[model samples]
Target chain A: MNHFIIKNRKDVQKLSTLAIFAGKTMLSNGAETYRVEDTINRICSSKENIKEVDSFVTQSGFFLTLEYEGEIFTYLKRVKDVGINLNKINLVNDFSRQFVNQDISLEKGMKTLDEINNIPGYPKYLKILGGSYVSGFFSLMYGGSPQDFLPSFIASFISLIILDKLSKFNLTFFIDRFIGAFLSSLLAIFAVKLGIGVNLDKIIIGSIMYLVPGVSITNSIRDTMSGDSLSGLSKGIEAILSALAIAFGVGIVLNLKSKGWI
Target chain B: MSVLLQFMYSFFATIGFAIYFGAPVNSIIPSGISGGASWSLYYIMFSILNDKILATFMGAFLVGTLGEALAIKYKKPATVFITPGIVPLVPGAGMYYTMSYLVGRNFNKAINAGTEVFFMAAAIAMGIIVSTIFTRTIRRFKRQN
Candidate 1:
């Protein structure tokens, strides 16, 4: 079901705003340039607060940014947690970036989650599931090169359609994220090897984007910068450990390829 | 054509990538413009020193100074523009290439690449730290006043 809690107004707004920026940043693959602009825009919009707001992403364990008044924060993560959701983030970021050139209202873009949540006739649980799926798929295809993007775009759409058919199984989000990334990466790699012109590096990194633990990476950097070495070290350690987990997961498939077991 | 336009285009492309990565909108364009102008220092330094690294440092210093001015002017964080502007200098692709070479067991190539990566990362880090310290000192001075 839609987990719509009426948090105290400030916190709720903060959470939603953070989610929007996090989602965007997540998609951009944590490139510094995009992040800088994103922070400036967010902070500029929130002129009244003039206080520090820290945002953490759960999946990536990365801190997006720490804003005190209007300044953005930055640092290198102690760990890397590459995964499929990172793909989803890129796709969404691409879509938004495309719209950046269009005349669409930013406020409307900002309200996408709420709009998805309040769709009529769909079961609340179904709506949430559907929204996540759509969002995931949209994000995966958004940031790719135009020509190569078509197939991944088509593949993502097809996967979501197929996923919807299998939704009755009620898998947890984490399980689905793993399965989705695994299958997508599998197809993406095959597509690249089979005479398609897609760049392997882009495919691997793009698909893994969906699952990278960005929040943790950002947090690790932030804690370190703020002189809380222990907190930073722990956060950095956690991020590094997660990166190993992701590398291992991808490594299994790569190993199979090496062993002629694929 | 004007030298300024070249810088503007480069700056725009840089900021465009930054926005794509998830920077707040307000910071991207302005930061980019400022980043390009920051290169002016390097242009001037090249004329005097004729040294690439020294020129690079001078340019970066100017960019950092400009970044501070923008932050104060916009009443936003210095990082919003500074991070993205300096991104062009980050050794990301170099680091990736070094790691790839090491993985492939090309020891000679890897070592060469690795050294470049180390230097680049260190320089970038130093630039950031220097600017940050500069800003902090200014802030402290203001408070003392």
Candidate 2:
């Protein structure tokens, strides 16, 4: 184990930078705010001669301050494009534990963090298949007949492709979900009209399950219970707004169908 | 559908979501099991109790407890398991019905479905909180000894 010593201001700056980067990776990848804060503090305090470490993390950004050798260095990062990727969170959690226990050099730690950040998620085709399975099986679970399964799968598969395409344009998450939900319901209706599906409501429910804010809802409550009320409230609002967006999307299609417009 | 079929469907659905969310590959099956078991519990409870909110609470509680146990065993964070496990229980159907009611101009039905949706969400939150507290307390006691 290397004895990592903070010998100068430059080393201190490097240490703080590493901590902030790790925190950013976690936050943007949908880790809880409290976990982000804890990871940052643990990383900063693990090295030698660090006098103080404080980190404040919210849904949008984070601020970290570290004191070493009579110098206080602070880092503020505004995180964007928050998405859910549980593998990254797990990797970072492991990295922090390893970092705190072993004397890993600051530069080495930075390199490892970079590697972790660059790791790609599952391939597109598999993710598409995964999305289809989610919707198809969910319809069956929700009491949809076996005939509805293929329709739910087809609707969600195409809409997930649309969602993936729309995300490339860097649209806000709300619009992406709105369009996704709208397309899925429309497709579900068409499937029924074509006699490919027997139950429109079941198909619609299953297809739209892809857009529900399950992660945000769970994280919001977990954050609040852990005393990070700010993060909790923000995530709760996010969940509500996404739910509403999905509702509006599906509601419009259902309304059109009711009026025989479709 | 039989309980066995519901469990099987939820298992595959949970695995699909676990992959979509990029959970670690080794942890996927464990999460699937937890998701399947909890959804089956929810199905049985809803049938017997006929209370959506209480049934949801029970389902969420099972997910949380099982997730925590799996996290400890796999040496990964709990969120990896809990996030995917809870998806089947989220009130997606209620939200859809609520919107349809509003669009059909059935204000009373809309309000009724909307309130139940809100309460179901809260019930899920409460269930998770209680399970977390339960685990933490048990850990504390073990450490004290």
User: Which of the numbered candidates is closest to the native, going by highest TM-score?
Assistant: 2
- Summarize candidate 1's per-residue lDDT along A73-155 as a digit string, tens digits: 44222223331222233334444443334443334545653443232332334333332332232222222353444344333
Over 4 Å off, model 1 = A1-226, A231-262, B1-10, B35-64, B142-145
lDDT of 2 by residue, A56-94 (tens): 999999999888878788888999989889999999999
RMSD of each: 13.3, 1.1
- Cα error, residue A234 of model 2, in Å, equals 0.4
Q: Would you estimate the TM-scores of all the predictions?
A: 0.42, 0.98
What lDDT is obtained when candidate 2 is compared to the true structure? 0.92
Candidate 2 Cα outliers beyond 4 Å, as residue runs = none
- Backbone clash tally for model 2? 0
Q: Give the TM-score of candidate 2.
A: 0.98
